[model samples]
Target: MIASSARLARAAGGSRNWLLGVLRGSSYGTASEASFQVESYKLHKLEQGPSTSVTLSRDDGLKMYRQMQTVRRMETMAGNLYKSKIIRGFCHLYSGQEAVCVGMENAMTPDDSVITAYRAHGWTFMRGVSVQGVLSELTGRVSGCAKGKGGSMHMYGHNFYGGNGIVGAQVPLGAGIAFASKYRGEEAICVTLYGDGAANQGQLYETFNMAKLWNLPCIFVCENNGYGMGTSVDRASASTAYYTRGDYVPGLWIDGMDVLAMREGTRFAKDYALKNGPILIEAVTYRYSGHSMSDPGTSYRPRSEIQEVREKRDPITNFRERLLSSGLATEEELKKIDTEVRKEVETAAEKAKTDQELPLEELYNNIYVDPPQGMKIRGCDPTIMASTR
Candidate 1:
């Protein structure tokens, strides 16, 4: 009956009714307006913070929910393929941190830039790469965004730098990108994300200094996901209050698990960074999977703790409940979206699994954007000189 209603709605004209008239299944449509009480941003060295309350329209709610759900499902599929050994080498799943990327991306414009660490599947998708693109990249297929070469931690999108493999490498690179934007006098800002593990890197502090010195428009985000490579944040850093770690730069501590909170905080930070200089944001999130595909993620932390977070603070589930309670959506509507997401992800997974990888002759093809004419690059062995495609 629900499927029939969906088909009927689609057949009618694929309007808003396609989402509402059928999925709503009610005389009165879902609430047109809703206000949610998101967690307040904890400020440091700043006079004001983002509002504790945020207004949500059905459109925004549905989009945010769907994006987060797609990321979660896609990451799950990546994990499954990795376990089966199809996706080899350096597979990092961003399962429990969906809200961070989804919320941040929704607040960003295409003109804005983003760069982040290796756990970048979610960010890659948020930046416009499809699930198929990300999965195929992981599987080293010809159809990947990087054309099967970059692999898991090197995927790129427009205005998105990379899935940088080095622990603290992307931070300074992001600063440079912001500097370039300022140099060109473009009204753009760059959001550079790193994990709690990278918090202690000296290069980050050096980049922070340079960013502030030049007044570059950069938002440095630390996704403090409690544990870093099996070690707790407490063990990783002497001072875990990452927001305050940037002594001169202003900071905001945010509830990373809450999508609304993340959105508001990022929106606020983006504006502040453009007007003033760089700002620091510590998004306190959690990760359900191991640091990489190789670790089981159980020896260091208790399974019960993971269960607790899933039960009490799972981002997707919490957002779904909020949508229902606030009348932004109905259970049936959300369920329909979930069903569609699963099917989309499953279809993408199948293609990624079966897609063809780049052939051998194409090697060293993208060595340089504009290589000199007749440039023959060295191949695997010095004896083998390869011509540029």
Candidate 2:
């Protein structure tokens, strides 16, 4: 009877009745039949294979989930600190876009380098900089990754080049790193990340041409978070498809909020670049905080929009759900991780607040490896000679 009804509905121009009946039968019908239908759907999707979910192992999923959670909590702590005026200077938080860094870092080896714009706390954390080091940097203390000189916008770790201040300037630097890696005959690749706002910079194209001309092993990533500072990507660039900005580089666009998809896409890009030269990946992610903690974050965008993204598509929440559904992790386990991460962030912030600021004289210390001849020495300048002239 159900088959006859489905046939009649299909005969009627593939109407809604056919779709509804199919769904009903699949859900409320025989278990065996439902299983068969699911298998058929999976096979069909595999054959089509345009947009599909990327498979992830339980260990990979859990690791990505933990990294993302750590970033989320760390950003949340920074926002609170900024509110209290504990952390000052241009601070860009990467709260809503954890998966991009976590996934890409997972695809990279320890020797591979990464450089990004001011929105870099996430990358720093993923690159093995302790939360304490990042918080200390924000607080301008001696314990920071840059020893308090490079504040929130310039933290670095071993192999992680920088949190560059110039908008799209890191592209060429990343290319340079890649050039060095290739010169040394190393298999390492450099991943340079930039914002949608920086995508319009003419230098990016120059770097792209050079990278391609030399067949450099570099992965140029554009984190298309919709807005660059106060300007939406649409307003800033005629061509908003940032991945395609590098016309010479093959491009891949992944759902940035989906950890599995990000991991799979980044892995594919890294491998392809290793073999076929450079590649570009555009991860469509979002940032929840203001471009920095100073901006109210509502002047250019709607609160409703941020709320929608958070409630519906939060990367951490999405990954948590997938893990639970797949039995890779339990809700209790995830909650414990969340609690521990929050506590760790809070402790780091407290330590950062009390850590001593860099000495005023240290400012002139690292200016040069050795002082230039006849260079005017300033107060406490380490360049001052100890000899009696």
lDDT of model 2, residue 234: 79
Q: Give the number of colliding residue pairs in candidate 1.
A: 0
Q: Write one digit per residue (lDDT tens) for candidate 2, span 1-389.
A: 23211211111111111211121122111211110010001111012211233445555666778889889888888888888898887889998899889978887889899999999999998999999999999889888888888988898998999899998999999999999999999998999999998898999999999999998999898898989889998788898777677886677776677565576677777777787788887888899878877678899999999997887677787566545544455677778878888889889998899999988877766655556665655553533543211
The CA lDDT of each predicted structure is 0.85, 0.75
- lDDT string, candidate 1, 1-389, tens digits: 11212221111111111212223323223666566666667788999999876766789999999999999999999999988999998999999899999999988899999999999999999999998899999999988889879888999999999999999999999999999999999989999999999999999999999999999999999999998899999888889999998888899998888898899898999999889999999998899999998899999999998987887778898777667755667788888999999999999989998999887867865666655656667543233333333
lDDT of 2 at 126: 90
User: Clashing residue pairs in candidate 2, if any?
Assistant: none
- Lowest lDDT sum, 10 consecutive residues, model 2, at 34-43
Please tell me which predicted candidate would have the highest lDDT against the true structure. Answer: 1
Candidate 2, position 309, lDDT? 84
lDDT of 1: 0.85
